[model samples]
Target: MDVLISGASVAGPVLAYWLRRRGFFPVVVERTPRPRLGLGGHAVDLFEPAMEVASRMGLVSALREARTESELLVLERPGRPAAELRLNAVVPAFDDDKHVEILRGELATILHGVTRDDVEYRFGDSIRTLAEDATGVDVTFESGETRRFDLVVGADGLHSRVRELVFGPESEFRHDLGGYFAVFSLPNYRRLVGKIVLHLGVNRMAAVYPVRQTKDARAVLMFRSDTTSQHDHRDVAAQRELVRKTYAGQEWELPRLLAAMDDADDFYLDTISQIRMPSWSRGRVVLVGDAGYSPGPAVGGGTTLAMVAAYVLAHALEEADGDHANAFAVYESRIRDYMRLCRDAAPRVLRNGVPRNRVHRAIAETSLRLLPRLPDRVRSRILAGGISGALSSFALPE
Candidate 1:
């Protein structure tokens, strides 16, 4: 079978890898001109299930070496003393022993590296239109080239062109969680090695952590918003402007961060939203990962979900013997509950992670101060009441 998978960041490459192993030819189309590899991009966590998928592919050791080894987390408040905690204690609340947090770009590069030699990767292009018939999907690319494939999988992220082309408009299925997330790279002026600096404010939060592999740091800024006004994902200038306006007059290294934002070329800003769909497949075309059912970015376990979903999808296809309809059905049935759990947990995760008022902020800080001192089992039990439970809710198929 000749399969065309859209979006090469994480899920596309993963799906391509598994499909190729199952004796299928997979072609990946990425909008970026080149593969996003190396140490760039934000830190993302892979839970036990996703880690199992990587281990099966023989990339866990490389992933472990490339982890964003931030051993300590320091919370900086405007007028209060900073509190410190170990990263390992906090991580177990959400993941098991099989967990690794790596940069999104590094993970993509590793996934691509495993599949590139066997898969056909077409960069700097995307699907312009997809016309599916009984036999195959006729795809026209933005580059004006046309091709036919036995199957088309939209492993694309939120705001997927594939979903828009086949399912409907994004707004029809998107649920805005009333927040925005922005991230960019800057020089490691703070010299923050093996540590993360965080500033939690009412209705807003800012964090910076060093990338161990490089002499650079990643600044993550998130804020709650009242309006659901649409922002163009491609408008970098406008996004930067929004961030500056939102963080104006903020203290504790924010001014420096904002100044760095002006010169940072890899700025990314997007609404923190979830995609809820009744179904993920239509005839020869199917959607996977964030393209089909993103819980939300950052707050939700999106990276873990994407990896596990892609792995399950390939297994489903293989089991069905290339009967796409049956495979899609099995894939959806297996992961639907898991997807919903993540989606439902996103709002609570966001609310707890990003303080909405002074009291919330105090509670968050107190938790940080108290978490490290508590016994391991007690701490895990307490923290597992939120996103942790939802993250480990899914069981991957054998």
Candidate 2:
């Protein structure tokens, strides 16, 4: 089978790898001109299922070596002492070795590294239109190249052009989560090595974390908004302006971060939203990762979900024995409930991960301060009880 997968981020490469393993010729189309390995990207977590997928791919050791070992998570408050949590204590109850956190770009590099030699990667191009018949999908690229494929998978992230082409408009699937987030790179002037420092205000939050083995740091700015702000995703200046206006006159290390943002060439800003589609497949086209059913960005275990989706989809196709309809049905049935669970986890994560008000912030800080002092058994119980989603395990098809 000749399969064309769009978007070469985490999900696209992963799907390509698995499809190649299943003896299918997979071609990946990335809009970017080249691999975004050196770009400024936020840290992402890989849960148990994703780790299992990596282990199967024989990339876990390399991923472990590339893990972001932030020694501390510091909570900075105005006119208050910073509360700290040892990263070790933050490990969930289930096997701590199963969860791995790495920068998005680093993970993408690792995934792309293992698959580049095997898959056909077309950089600086994207599918302009997809026309499907009973036999295959006829794809026309923005470069004016046309090709036919047995199947087309939209592994693109949120705001996927593939989904917009195959499905209807984006408004039909987009479910705004009432917030916005921005990530940029900055110099580590505070000398915060192996640490993540977060500052919280009434309706806004800002965090800076050190990149492994680098003097540069990554900054994330998030805020609660009354309604979703509309802007072109490619418009960096407009997005930066929105962030600046939202966080004007903010104290507690924000001014320095803002100044650093001006120097960053890879500033990324987006709305914290979820994509929920009733069906992920239509005829010869299907969607995966954030393009189909993103729970939420950053905090929603999106990386893990994407890996799991890739694994399941590949196996489904193999098991269905060339029946695309059966494979798509099985794929959707197996992942739908889990996708909903991930989607519902967003608000809870935002609240606990980035506390809203002073009271919640105090409670969060107190928990972090007390976590390290607790006994191993007690800590395990607390983690299992408190963060069930983080520790949630998924069984994959053999």
- Output the number of the TM-score-best candidate: 1
> Best-fitting candidate, measured by lDDT?
1
Each candidate structure's count of clashing pairs: 0, 0
Clashing pairs in 1: none
TM-scores, all models, native as reference: 0.97, 0.95
Please write out the lDDT profile of model 2 over residues 1-398, one tens digit for every residue. Answer: 99999999999999899999889999999999998775348888887888889989999888888888887889887788888888767676222558888889899999889999989999999999999999999999999999999999999899898899988888899888878888988887888878899887767889998886588888998887765747777888888888888788988988888888888987998888899888999998999999999887875778889999988999899898899999999999998877777777776777776667888877877877898899988887776543345426578777
TM-score attained by model 1: 0.97
Q: Rate the local accuracy (lDDT) of all candidates.
A: 0.89, 0.84
Worst 10 residues of 1 by lDDT: 88-97
Query: Candidate 1 on 170-265: residue-level lDDT in tens?
Result: 989998899999999999999999999999988899999998888889999989987645678788888888889889998889999999999998
